[model samples]
Target: MIKPTPNPPELDDTTPYEFPGSKRFHEAAERALDHYLKPNALTLRFHKPSTMFQIAPDQDNESLLAHACESLASASIMTSDIAAYVDNPQRHTILAIQQIIMLAELAVNRVLDNVEMARSASHN
Candidate 1:
């Protein structure tokens, strides 16, 4: 019979992420451990970023930091999503970059919190 609705998707016995026997329920364990427990901790060195785009001086620090946090968050998501389609050792490199972006986003969030706290304290 030519019904209006299409056939339902077939169910699978297992999911792609069902690697309990392999990694044991933690997909990000290796990345998290590698990030925190590396021997001889790596130093964060900075290079001058391109000045082609910049926030206006009139913008408040909290707003600027908030925008930076959002931007880093987006970048981190992009790298992680792309990494899923990539094969190692390139996938490892992309994941590492995502980890770094996550760290930067966290730092920016911290600074934003500090600025907001100070602003509140000044108002009190």
Candidate 2:
């Protein structure tokens, strides 16, 4: 009878599987993946209204209305910007939202025009 061959040594989970020089390659790849995949914290922050539109303690009705108009105008611009980046199919929805924003902006502009006219008439 022939002698039985010995089994090869078992590799434990604690053993390093990487070849030489591969560790640095893997680290560089991980850094590149992280750079591309990581989301920006600043972009995820909640947005607040601009300080320019903030109401002062002594703000008048006309000034408040003007600020509202400016805010609506800004909203329209933002909606358009959002629509610009959207892909097809979903882009249609963004465009619809942009249209609604524009409508609201137009309505606010009309109100602002009427307020200005009244203010001018009163002043005269």
List RMSD in Å for every model shown: 15.2, 13.2
Model 1 sits at a Cα RMSD from the real structure of: 15.2
Q: What are the runs in model 2 whose C-alpha is more than 4 Å off?
A: 1-58
TM-score of 1: 0.56
lDDT, each prediction:
0.83, 0.77
The superposed Cα distance between candidate 1 and the true structure at residue 22, in angstroms, equals 52
| Residue 70 Cα positional deviation in candidate 1, in Å, after optimal superposition | 0.5
* Most TM-score-accurate candidate: 1
Residues 1-124, model 1: lDDT tens digits: 7867557855668865655575554557877786778643233344456789877779977777888899999999999899999899999999999999999998998888888889899999
Per-residue alpha-carbon lDDT of candidate 2 for residues 1-124, written as tens digits (9 for 90 to 100): 6547545655666624367777777888889997789756775575555788555789887677777778877887887888788898888987888788778878877887898898899999
Residue 40 error, candidate 1, Å? 36
Span of 10 residues, lowest total lDDT, candidate 1: 39-48
TM-score of each: 0.56, 0.49
